[model samples]
Target: MPATTVLRPRSRTLIIAATVPLALAALLADDVRVRRQLDAVPPDPTSSRTDSTTLVPASS
Candidate 1:
């Protein structure tokens, strides 16, 4: 009997596993810049008030 190697499924699994983390890392990598920009925006006491009654209604 001759020995045979199966390559297709194994290669496919490796490619899929590698791609998942690379994609997630790319998504999370953009958050750093986003967080930096968000930090620059001054927090408004009126907007962040826990009491909804404190929020000013926008005029139509």
Candidate 2:
């Protein structure tokens, strides 16, 4: 197996410089898409309440 070598300062700097902007841009884009979807959806009044009952009464 080859010995692991740590990245040099310049290579590390270049990697961070390239990746950070892309990561931030992707995050911002996802936020924008979610906001748009939320805005486009009409609110449903039925979704505000749940009527499910879990009780099982003993049969007489």
Candidate 3:
């Protein structure tokens, strides 16, 4: 016969409490890394150019 082990409520709570901070830290680090990479790129100069084509039909 195999023996089964069960976790107490206090143990389960402690395990969950320990993981919350680690998860938050990982998310914060990833956000900072992405923001830094985005800041390093330069903006395009031609993106502000507007189209001047006319789309009206000529009437007879």
TM-score of each: 0.50, 0.65, 0.64
The lowest-lDDT stretch of 10 consecutive residues in candidate 3 is: 48-57
What tens digits encode model 2's per-residue C-alpha lDDT throughout 10-58?
9999999999999999999999998888768776667643432334566
Estimate the Cα RMSD of every predicted model relative to the unseen true structure: 8.2, 9.6, 10.4
Of the two candidates 1 and 2, the one with more favorable lDDT, higher being better, is 2
What local lDDT does model 1 show for residue 4?
Answer: 78
The model with the greater TM-score, 1 or 3, is 3
Better of 2 and 3 by TM-score: 2
lDDT of 1 at 6: 58
Off by over 4 Å in 1: 1-7, 42-60
Candidate 3 residue lDDT tens string, 1-60: 345667889999999999999999999999999888876767657765243233455698
Which 10-residue window of candidate 2 scores lowest in summed lDDT? 48-57
Q: Cα lDDT for residue 28, model 2?
A: 100
1-60 per-residue lDDT for model 1 (tens digits)? 335755589898999999999999988989988878877777678765664335577799
